[model samples]
Target: MKLITEKAELFFDLMWSLQFFINTELKILTKIKNRKEYAALPQKDKQVVREKIYEQPELIDKYIASNPDRLNDNHLSIIKQWKNFIKGDFYIERYLKNHAIFVGDNNVYGVLGLHDAFDHLFPSNYLPIYVKTILLPFQGRIVYDGLMQVYQVSFGGGIKRSLSETYMQAKQNNKIITTLEKTRVKIESKAFVEVEQENIWTNEIEQLKSLSKKLKGGDGQPAINSPVFSLVKASIALADKALFDPSDIDALTKELQKVERAVRKVENTLDRML
Candidate 1:
């Protein structure tokens, strides 16, 4: 969805002021006499100035030092954060309720739209649209810098599915970047999740083993002493083994089928005994 209206206005005000400052400081564009003219310039012309600012990120510091607008510390802090900007080609993979998904070379960003929602800009069938843009931190969210260069390259079904998978992987791993400042926290959080997931599986397997041990046949004999309970114990053992290497899909499938068959045979055997 679009950014909050007031925030969007503040963004343009600060951004336009800074770009115009850069233009004059570097004389990148001579014709742009004022912020009004600079704002009205074509996206391509604005892109030229935008690239220059990024190329020399030190300009952001210079602008902060100048503080020509006499902006408050909070507002200047927002502008100073532009130094952490991420620039590259990204695929606009999908649009969700809160934010649209922008998948880059290695990071997925939850980017908010400016004046219009991303879905309104590009139809679902048109995605994953490839575009070159700059992702900046605004307030506490990620947003593009009001200019995008879209490529006309069309993707086939395979590439489309691959891009979709990339988005899903980032989501499942909790790796979708929401803020530029918390990037380090996100990486450490991902590692914690991975360890916790493995521990969950390990605990489940141990519980299963304990349950099997309590299912003794009789007179303190192991459950395997009885033909009927042997299948039940085997099923638990197979499940424990399967959990150890959950990533081996084919192997896990085979183990699961074996466990199902063994349990079914035990059910039938008990029916005959009764």
Candidate 2:
């Protein structure tokens, strides 16, 4: 399965714009706070400036209202959604918690807003399995926070191929794929193999144990001690075979099952000794 489908590209675009807006807003706030005049002001004046720049809601509302032409309808809608959520105490707490998941040391509204935008655009259930498998393993890493970074690293930098070109190449030639895409493909292909091996190994081990218990002699020794020991050895061998030679798994699993059934039949006929 492909990692970045057409639907996924739409979500990526939405997230990229949301993150850009958030980053720009943060930079503007930082510039205001760090201005020489703001710093040189008296404590009373500085407090007033801080409250107006940082604490006041009217400033953001006015900015959004004035910037309608600069932002598309979708962007405006997202900004309004953010404004509404920030007003609620519970939403503020959850937003902070969500921000903590992807970023460290930079817990600003931008990062929180970026996360919220992603959650809005693509709910967890709606994300592609391959994309989830790729990103979930590296959630703590900075590069895992957004698709733009992943796209850059996966495709290379400095005059490298565009996303469209790379995506086309991925379709034609799997050899030049990104590490993340390669890993996703590998995981997708091996999932069934791993599951089948695990099921066979677990079932055989349980069956062997059950057969051993049923064949117990009155002297507290297993009645078919030699056969039980051989089956135990065979179980281990089958597990090793499944791990090393998966192509032969079905046949090996069937043989083990046949042996288990034979042992069960013999054990059921044997009477308890005095």
**For model 1, how does the per-residue alpha-carbon lDDT over 1-274 read when each residue is reduced to its tens digit?**
7798888999999998899999999888998788889988877787777888799999999999999878899999999888999999999988889899999886888999887888888987787899999999988788999988899998899988988888889998667887775665577678876875665677777887888877656686644346556666777777776657656778777777877777777677667767
Using lDDT, give the best candidate's number.
1
Q: Which candidate is the best by TM-score?
A: 1
lDDT of 2: 0.38
Residue-wise lDDT of candidate 2 within 1-274, one digit each (tens)? Answer: 1223543343444333433333245453344432343434444433333333234445446556766237676555433333222110111111123332221122212122223354554443432111210121111111122322111112233322233243344344332211222345477458745675565566666565566555434466666664555565556556656555656858788758856865764565454432
What TM-score does each of the candidates earn? 0.71, 0.25
Kindly provide the TM-score of model 1 when superposed on the true structure, using C-alpha atoms: 0.71
Count clashing residue pairs per candidate: 0, 0
